[model samples]
Target: MVFEYILKKNGLDPSTDLTIDQSISFGLTAAAFTSSDADYTIEFEPFATTLELEGNGSVVASLGTESGYVPYTAYSARKSYIKQHPEVIQSFTNAIQRGLDYVNSHSSEEIAKTISPQFKETPLDKLTQIVERYKAQDTWKEDTVFEESSFELLERILEEAGQLKETVPYKELVTTEFSTKAVK
Candidate 1:
């Protein structure tokens, strides 16, 4: 969404010319960064050959998993970064808030169906089960509230790379105004 917003600001029509799923892997600090890290990339031609380039940078910067395994002090570092890169604050917040809204509004079945349809054997049932398990997980929030701990992890990454311009205040970076309409 951030990338699309940037493109739109440049007077580009994303839907007509681009199809982007904006999911950025942020770091704990500006010191933390990743490049060409995505497993796959595509060229301009419609049938262009695909490339596998896990470009560069560390493996990860946060919990590394939604279940919170591989624990690290990333959240702390991410929060500190917000205090530095105020300009990028809104974009970061908007993206998460938008994602959370989509997740909250849809049922596991509906979401799974919309997200991917290539699941293997017994897909519909399996997908439903997966969604149910996801719903059972605790502490799901659909609001956009800039979390210091969460940003701390991102901070460690961007800071290391000297990406921060001005420290952003947590309060200025987020709002729940769209929370109600965000979810289905």
Candidate 2:
């Protein structure tokens, strides 16, 4: 989506000008680039670190700042599910908020040490670098509330990518009721 947006913003049509192929996974994308099957691949940290560790490639375009695409994670539920289990939603949101708080308060090295065991194949130094990069980018939100401007930017990007037909109002798309309760 960011690719499409960037291309269009630069007055180029992505669909007509670019030969885009979808890879099944980020690892596969990295493999494609490494094998000389593809010229470039869009990837984020940890995985990008893995690619570099394998001596495949280096990150050329850093979207961390230019894209205004921070807070790269979200949780969602079906409207019916949310209506039926509001408390569950609150519980989930609250737990995530607490986790985000812990991450924000702790150093990247501390976070890397805590989560490193789960990613046994990833070297500690690489994992630490990924964590530190994300921390520096302020990738995690301090609270669960969705920011309107960021949401609008996401919608614009999607629209530019032709994934969305029309602009959807933020209130219609997201319910902050649970997030508000969770943050408190």
- The model with the greatest lDDT is 2
TM-score, candidate 1, is: 0.33
* Residue-by-residue lDDT tens digits, candidate 1, 46-127: 1111111222332221113332221122122255665576446545556667766777888878866875555543356456
All candidates' TM-scores?
Answer: 0.33, 0.84
lDDT of 2 by residue, 102-183 (tens): 8999988899999999989888888898898788776777888888877898888877777989898888878888888877
Regions more than 4 Å wrong, model 1: 1-85, 117-124, 144-184
CA displacement after TM-score superposition, residue 54 of candidate 1 (Å): 33
Angstrom error at residue 165, model 2: 1.4
- Evaluated at residue 116, the lDDT of candidate 1 is 53
Count of residue pairs whose backbone atoms collide, per candidate: 41, 0
Question: RMSD of model 2, in Å?
Answer: 2.4
Cα lDDT over the full model 2: 0.80
Superposed by TM-score, candidate 1 places the C-alpha of residue 90 at a distance from the truth, in angstroms, of 1.7
